[model samples]
Target: MTEPRICSDDYGILTSARDWLAAGREPALVTVLKTWGSSPRPPGSLLVMCRDAGHAGSVSGGCVEADLLERYRSGELGELPTRVDYGVNREEATRFGLPCGGRLELLVEALTDAAQLDELLAAMDAHRLLAREVDPASGRVRLRPAGPEPTFACGESGVTRVFGPAWRMLLIGAGHLSQYVSRLALMLDFDVIVCDPREEYARDWQVPGTRLVTLMPDDAVAAYTGHPRSIVLALTHDPKLDDLALLDALVSDAFYVGAIGSRRNCELRRRRLRDMGLPESQLQRLYAPVGLPIGSHTPPEIAVSILAEITALRNAAAPSAGARSITAA
Candidate 1:
């Protein structure tokens, strides 16, 4: 899988892009178009350092900043856009101290057209993935659909794809545990939705910014059409509700589908799902014993474990990927 792209706007790159766009002068956008060997960030990592606005995005692990800063100070990048390669050999790697001999290729594009920059920003704000191509020799910019094309922009500079939006979470229960989970989800920038059909539960739900709904759990999951970016957790522990919701969630695109239950109950639930025509692979996606094995015995403690696991999944830094890969029950 391709490493996800970072938004120029998200990492405070908007300020630099805006300043250059406002000045009616082209500014250099230095992006770590590709990387090999040990690197802090993946491909598409960016540094939109402009002539006037300074720097955005980290290309190297603080090793290249001094040189980049010097280049910025000397106006070496102002002439036009350029492609620069760093860490060619052992000596160069030692000079830069790239930590594990990492080599990075940077594509610098002179963004002269404010309209194009504005369009890129708007597309990102709207949660669209964009592939930006620049001419290595001429520094011309072109926006194309994000995918594998031998070459885009008609043999221009290499392509850098920018991915937008954080992941989303939907909680099927708005109970005590849901409160803590929702709070942490917001802090993690996940768009959260809480669903509960019980009037009392929905009425008593008081967490701010969480989308509260009284829809049936199964219908709510169906309506959501959970995607790879979505996570659904059935914390109600009520089979009548959670079972159906879990059934819907397992068949959807949700990357994580979990429920709060004991080992025995989880086994029963799995058997029922398997009997309902769910494939063994699909059934395996159910994280019945949700969260990590932190021996969490309380609602708030369980919430912390759940949030930690979710964060690991989101960052792709988890020791193991997949729903049942980590179980605390």
Candidate 2:
């Protein structure tokens, strides 16, 4: 069992902003709308700030956080949706901790519409990716379903921002390996769920910041039928538990689907899925023998291997270690 994790990304910040607004603090939400030449954080990163000098999330990776806070204290940032830039010059870049020639552009919106924040959170809970568009002049806001992951954009009329759930994982096991994987998932800002039907194994599962479900893998897999931005990890190594979820994950739109096994077992699993009539394209999406082949034997090492591959996939980079490709039977 691990202690609860501290969530520092948009997931935590947005939720914190909702709570802060309810507590009578009208916080402004700052967004990194654009960056150029080696900025610390990527576009679309967020920071929620309050007048009393409290803040959540990050826009500069701690480089300009103190400076931003100092401005708030000095009344330099008035109550307005303002545009700001940092690292514009060499000395300023060094002072702000940006890369030598980095630049960051921000949109600081003083949010008064608690209802809009509520709507954004609701859409996320419903597993819907939303685009929140704001017109600078009129201050009109519109929220709608988003198409795909895109960087924040700005035009003459307005700013467009995308909001969605944090990364999530469904681990089909609750053993020691699952423990390690659960810890890694939480560290990566993923909402984790561990499912195992065996009462004996489930009884002692005590990882914090994760949901423990005493349900069969098939039923657990059914719960996330069409989930996007999720990873289905079959670490139980039991055919009964891993197979059902792996099958469902392959057909689902989850960004990643994987199972833990040896190369031979992965081949067997591939044949089994092919017999189940899965399309070749879909079958190719499954990373059986899941994780980079890092020669890992311990639970922690294996967990690292798994996260490395997931990180690669998330970043659109080639897998770091040796990769496994399952051919159609």
Candidate 3:
């Protein structure tokens, strides 16, 4: 098994906030409520700062965090939740390390309820999706089941940000391509699990920060919980292993299912799976000959193309702005 991964999610920050509050220390929780133009971090990014000068997570590269820390320490940010904006103009954007023309609006709240933080963390631990809503005027926080997708919204009424597990990627093979794919996925904040049952392949699979499962591909898929936030990539290029995983992933709710192969091989694999009883609708969900048409041939280039396509599809599927419904209270 590979070494444990550094969790690439906000849960670590939330956990730290809970611990600090439980120790009778008041900390400030800053959330990026909105962004315009070329912001460094997206809306829903988190930053938690303790009065003792410790901090976790980030809303910007570094400058914004420095300013936020100063304000937090100087008591400018009080117990009540308030909105703070940075990089409203080009000069400010440069000063704050945001891209030119970038703008960020933040919600800063003093955390006093360890119970609430614990409850939110509990939901996440149980694999339950949740949305946290904060009222600026009254400093009230509410938690409820989140929608099928993650989202963030803010207006005069308050701020609502969905919190859920980190996205996951399950690779069906531990080949050379799998190594590159796994490394790239980790950098993108995905929990990567690789399944390769062959003793020869599994023995030398030494990618830190990834989990290696020896179970058969189909059983690995079954145990992985193909939730909507999951990605399944069959990189084995072997019909015996890759096909077994595809049969399971195609029928599941995993947001992205892909297989790396030549166009001809992909079509052949498609027919093979279809003949094995996978419906046309589910088969249509498969991204065969996976990756964008970037003409990639090398392992590293192919890995980049694969992740690029996944990123494009994921963003394309995000809820429309109208669904989040920004409004002033």
Most accurate candidate by lDDT: 3
For model 2, give the 10-residue run with minimal summed lDDT. 320-329
Distance from true location, Cα of 258 in model 2, Å:
0.4
Candidates' C-alpha lDDT: 0.70, 0.79, 0.82
Candidate 3 lDDT over 229-273, as tens digits, reads 789999988999999999998888787888888878888898899
On TM-score, the stronger of 2 and 3 is 3
Per-residue C-alpha lDDT of model 2 across residues 1-329, encoded as one tens digit per residue: 34224243655777888888988877888888788888888887889888788999889869698888778667797756777899889889888999868999887777778888888877666666888998765657898888556536777867888777666789998999999999998888888888899999999999988888877887877774345677899988788788888788878777788888888888888788889888887878888778877889999999999999898877768642223454311
Which scores greater on lDDT, model 1 or model 2? 2
Which tens-of-lDDT digit does each residue in 175-263 have in candidate 1? 99999999988887676889999998899999886778788998888765365556899999888888889888988877788888888
The true-versus-predicted C-alpha distance at residue 242 of model 2, in Å, is 1.4
lDDT of 1: 0.70
lDDT minimum window of 10 residues, candidate 1: 147-156
By TM-score, the best candidate is: 3
Pairs clashing within candidate 3 = none
